[model samples]
Target: MLLLQANNVERRFGADILFHNVNMQIDEHSRTALVGRNGAGKTTLLKMIAGITEPDEGTISKAHDLSIGYLAQDQGLDSQNNIWDELDSVFAPLHEMEKSIHQLEEKLSSIDSTTDEYQYIIQQYDHLQTTFKEQGGFEYASKMRGVLTGFGFGEDMYDLPINSLSGGQKTKLALAKILLQEPQLLILDEPTNHLDMNVLNWLEDYLRGYNGSVLVVSHDRYFLDHVVSQVYDLDNQTLTHYTGNYSAFTKEKADWLRAEMKHYDQQQKKIAKLEDFVNKNLVRASTTKRAQARRKQLEKMDRMERPTTDDSSIHFSFHSDKDSGNEVLDVENLKVGYNENVLAGPLSFKERKGQRIGIIGPNGIGKSTLLKTILKKQPAISGSIKLGANLEIGYYDQEQQQLHPDKTVLDEVWDDHPEVPETEIRSLLGSFLFVGDDVFKTVKELSGGQKARLELTKLSFQPINFLILDEPTNHLDIDSREVLETAINEFTGTVLFVSHDRYFLNQVATDILNMSSTGITHYQGNYDDFVNETSTLSQNEDKTTIPSTTQTSSKKSAGQQSYQASKQNQRARRKIQREVDKFEQEMDSLQAKHDQIEQQMSAPEVATDIAKLSDLQKQLDECQQQLDQAEENWTDAAERLEEFDQE
Candidate 1:
C-alpha cells in the first residue's frame, strides 16, 4: 500500500526552478533514502513531502489520518521539563487512558457489585485495557528507556534539564522523542549528523525494526546502505529511483548513464550524416526529389536532446614543496587540555612521513585538543612532541578558525599569498566552486559547506609535508568527502586527522588511533581492521575466564581462582548466547510472515478486497511489533555480552 505520493511536483525559488515534474512515492513499510550533492534541492523536496513547504505545482496524496514525524537538521527540543518528562510527553494519550481507567476503578469500588453503574464501569475498564494494550501503553516506558540508552543517555542523566543539554544531546533527545511517537511515516533530514558510531549502529537496528515508512535525506552512505532498501537520486533538477542500497545505486547509475550517453551519441551521428547527404544532393536537379524527401523526414522526426550531468564540484589537489624525514612526528606521554586539566593522553605514538593516521573517539574526549597541541595552537598539559626536519604543517580546522569572516572569498586567499595575481586567485576560487561574483562575497555570508570548501582551497595552495585536519569532512557533501579522500590518498605527505566519517577513515587511513579519557590505543590498520582486532581480543578474553563458583576451597590458589573465573565467564556467555539465538529465531519468523503478507496483499483478489486488505495490514502490524521486540531483545543481549567481554 502507498502511504504517500507526490505527483508532478514543482518547486521554484524566485525566478529559479529548484526542481520540476518531480514524482515520488513512499509505500507502507518502505525504507527510502534521498541523496544528492549539496544545494541540489534534496532537502527542499523532503520539506515538500513533510508539509513544511508547499510545491508550486503538484498534488501530494497521503493515506487518511496518516501520522508523520519529521526531524530536520538541528531540530532541537524546547522544554523546561527534564529529559524523561520531555520524552514521556509523547505518550500523553496513553497517560490519559490510564487516568480514565483509574477513575473507573475507583468509581466501581464505591458501587454495589450488582448495580448497573458497577457493570458499566467494568465494561469501561475492560475497553480501556484493550485499548491500552493495542496502543503499547505497558511497553512505552521500556521502549523509551531503550531509545534513551541507545543514544547514549544513561539513567543518571535522565533527570537532567532538557534546556541544559548540549546541541548534539538535544538533537539526540529530539530523535528519541520522535522514535517514541511511532508515527505512520518518519521523515529524517541528516539524522546521522550528531551520532557517534555506536549510536549510528543502534539507529540502524532501530529503524530496520520500525513499523512505518521512512524517507530520509542524508549524505551518510554507510548509514543509508545499512538501513534503506531503496535510494532516490536527486540531480540536475530531477529525481531518479534506484532499486537497492547506496553501493548498488552507484553501479546501476553508472551503467545507466553510460548506456544513455552512448545512445545519444549514436543518434547525433545519424542526424549529422542525414544533414550532410541532404546538403550535398540539394543543388542537383535530378537529386532534388531525394533532397526534398530527406528534408521532409528530418522535419517529421522527433529530435532527441543531449543529456546533461551534474559536474559542479570542487577540483583541487594538495602538494608539498619538500619531503619530511622518515619519522615525521613523535609524541611521548603527551597530555592535551586547557589550563591544568588533562582531557586525554599520557599517550605516546610515532608517525612516519607517509603514514595517514585517523584519530577517533567519543564526543569531547579531546581529539581536537590533541591536534591543537601537536600544531602548537594550545599548550600540552604534559610530556613532549617532536617534529621532523624540513617539515611544514598545514592544518584544516573544523571550526574554520583561520578564516577572516569580514574578508571576501577572493581576499581571504589573496591576502595569504600577496604575490599571487588577482586573476590567478579567481581561478583558484573557481576550482573550489566559488565562481565569478561568489568570490566577491564575504566569508561571513558563506554556508558551512561553502566555508569548508574555501578552507580546503586555501589548504591546497600551502606547501606542507604534514597535514593535521580536525573533522575536515564535517560540513562536506558525499562527493566532496570522496574527493578529499582521494586527495589525501594521493598526497605523498603524512596525515594525522580526526573524523567521525567511518567511510572516509576506511578509505584514507593507513592506521587508526582509538582515544578515550583513560588513554589511546594504536591499531596497525584502518577502521575496519581496528574493529576486527578489538573484537578478536575481546572474544579471547571472554573465553579465557573461569567461574568463581568452580573453586571448592574458601581460600584458593591463584591458578584455581583463574580457572573458576573462566568457568563463570563461560556460563554468562552461554546465557547471553541463548538469548541472542532466541531473538534471532523470532526475528526470522516475523520477517517471513511479513514477506508473506506483502505477497498476499499483491494478489489480484486481495488487492480488490478491502476487508482482506485491512486484515493483512493488521497482520503486518503484529509482525512488526514482534520483530521490534525481537530486535530489542537481541540488542540488549549483545550489549550485555560486550560489557562482559570488556570486563
Candidate 2:
C-alpha cells in the first residue's frame, strides 16, 4: 500500500526555485534514501514532506491515519522528565486503559452477582485486556529498555534527566523515542551525525528490520548502502529515482549520464548539419524547396537541453616539496589523555613513509587525543614519539579552531602566505569554492563545510610530508568526502589520521590501527580487512588465546633452542603462507561467481522472471557465504604468518 505521495512539489525562496516538479512515493515497508550535496535544499524538501512546512506549489497526499516521525539533524529532546519516563509516556493510553480496568475490577467486587452493571463492567474489562495485549502493553518496558541499550544507554542512565544529556546523547535519545513509537513513516535527516561504528551497525540492523517505511537523508555512504534499497538523487533542482542501493545508484547514474551525453551529442551533430544546409541553401533558387523542408523538420524537432551535472566542488590536492625518511613516525608505549589521565594505550605503532594509517575506536576512546599528543598540542601521559628526518607535519583539526574567526576567508589564506599575489590567492580561494564576495565573508560566517574547505586550502599551501587529521570528514557531504578521499589517496606523504568514516577508511587507508583502552591492534589493511581479521581472531578465541607482544617476546626468549627448531619454525611459516595463498584463490573464485550471479539477477529478462531471479538470489547468497568463509580463512592464515615474522 502507498503510505504517502508527493506530486509536482515545488519550493521557492523569493524568486529562486530551490526544487520544482518533485515527485516521490513511499510504500509500506519501503526503504528510501534522499541524497544530495550540501546546500541542495534536502532539509527543506524533507520538512515539506513531513508536513512541518508547505511547498510553494505541489500536493502531498498521505494514507488515512498515517503517523510520521521526523528527526531533524542534531535535533534533541527537550523534556524535564527522565529518560525512562520520557519513553514510558509513549504508553500513556495503555496506562490509562490499565487504570480503567483496575477500576472496573474494583467495581465488580462491590456489585451484586449477575447485575447488569457488573456484566457491562466485565465486558469492558475483557475488551480493554484484549486491546492492551494487542497494543503490546506487557512488552513496552522491555522494548524501551532494548532501544535505550541499543543507543548505548544503560539501566543506570534511565533515571538521568533528558536535559542533562550531552547534545549527541540527547539526539540519540530522541531517535530512540521515535523508534519506540513505531510510526507508519520515519523521516530522518543526518541521523548518523554523532554515531560511532558500533552504534551505526546496530542502527543499520534495526532499520533493515523496521516495519514502517523510512525516508532518510544521510551522508554516511556505508550506512546507506546497507539500509536503503532505493535511492532518490536530488540534484540540479530535480529529484530522480534510482532502483538500487547507493553503490548501484552511483554506477547507474554514471551510465545514465554517459548515455544522455551521447544522445545529446548525436542530436547536436544532426542539428548542425540541418542548420548548415538551411543557411547555405535557403538563399539558392535550385535547393529552396529542400531547404524549406529541412527548416520545417528542424522546427518540429524537440531539442535536448545540454546535459549538466553538478561540478561546483572544491578542487585541491596536497603536495610535498621533498620526501620524508623511510620511517615517518614511531611511537612506543604512548599514553594519550588530559591532565595525566590515560584514556587509551600503552599503544605502539610505526608509520612508514607514504602510508595512510586510519585510527578507529569507539567514541571518547582517545583517538583525537592521540593525534594531539603526537603533534605536542597536548602532553602525553607517558612514552615517547619520534619523528623522522625531513618530516614537515600538517594537521587538520576537526574543530576548525585553527581558523581565525575574525579574519575574512581571503585573509585566512593570504595571512599565512603573504608573498603570494592577491589575484593568485583569490584564485586559490575560488578553487576551494570561495568566490568573489564569498571570500570577503568572515571566517565566523562560514558553515562547517566551508571551514573544513578553508582548512584544506591552508593545508594545500604548505609543503608538508606528513598529515595528521582528526575526523576530517566530519562536516563534509558525500561528494566532498569523496573528493577529500581522492586528495588523501593522491598525496605523497605519510598520514596518521583519526576517522569514523569506514568508507573513507576503505578508500584511503593502507592500514588500520584499532585503538582500545587496553592496547592497540594494528591490522595491515583497510576497514573491511580489519573487520575480517578481528572476526577471525574472535572466532578462534576459544581454541587458543592470541599472545600479546610482551608474551610473544617472552616466548621467543624461552623457545630459543637448536638449529632444527628454527628450521621447523620456518617450515611452519611456509605451510601457513601456502594456506593463505589457497584461501586467497578460493575467495577470488567465489567472489567472481557472486558477481556473475548478481549480473544475471540484474538482467532485464531474468528480473521479470520471478523463479529465475529467486534461484539466482539463492545462488548469490551461497556464493557470498563461501566467499566470507574463504576471507576468514585467509585472515587467519595471514595472521599466523605475521606472528611468525614478528618472532
- The model with the greatest lDDT is 2
What local lDDT does model 1 show for residue 571? 53
Per residue, candidate 2 scores C-alpha lDDT tens digits across 1-647 of 99999999999889999999999999999999999889988999999989999999989999999999999999999999999999999889989988988898888899996888888888888999999899998899999988998889999999999999899999999999999989999999999988999899889879988999999999998788778989998889989999977877886887788889999999999999999999999999999999999999999999999888764688899999998999889999999898878899899999999899999998989998889889999998999999999988999999999999999999999988999999999998888888879999999999999999999999998998999999999988888898898788778889999999987887788899999997898999778668768755754664454567547544433432332253345456656987998899999899889989988998999999999999988888888888989999999999988787656
In model 1, the runs with Cα more than 4 Å from the true position are 539-647
Q: Write the per-residue lDDT of candidate 1 for residues 1-647, one digit (tens) a residue.
A: 98999999998889999888888999999999998899889888888898888999998988999999999998989899999999999999999999998998889888899988888889889999999999998999999899999999999999999999899999999999999998999999999988888899789878988999899988787678678989988888888899987766876787788778898899888889889989999999999899888888888878777766664778888999988889899999999889989898798999998999999898888999999999898999899999889898999999998999999999999999999999999999988999879999999999999999999999998997899999999889988888888788779899999988877887788899999888898998777677668766865666545666325222333533443354445456756976887888888988998999999999999999999999999999988988898899889998987786556
In order, the Cα lDDT scores of the candidates are: 0.87, 0.89
Per-model TM-score, in order, reads 0.82, 0.82
Worst 10 residues of 2 by lDDT: 555-564
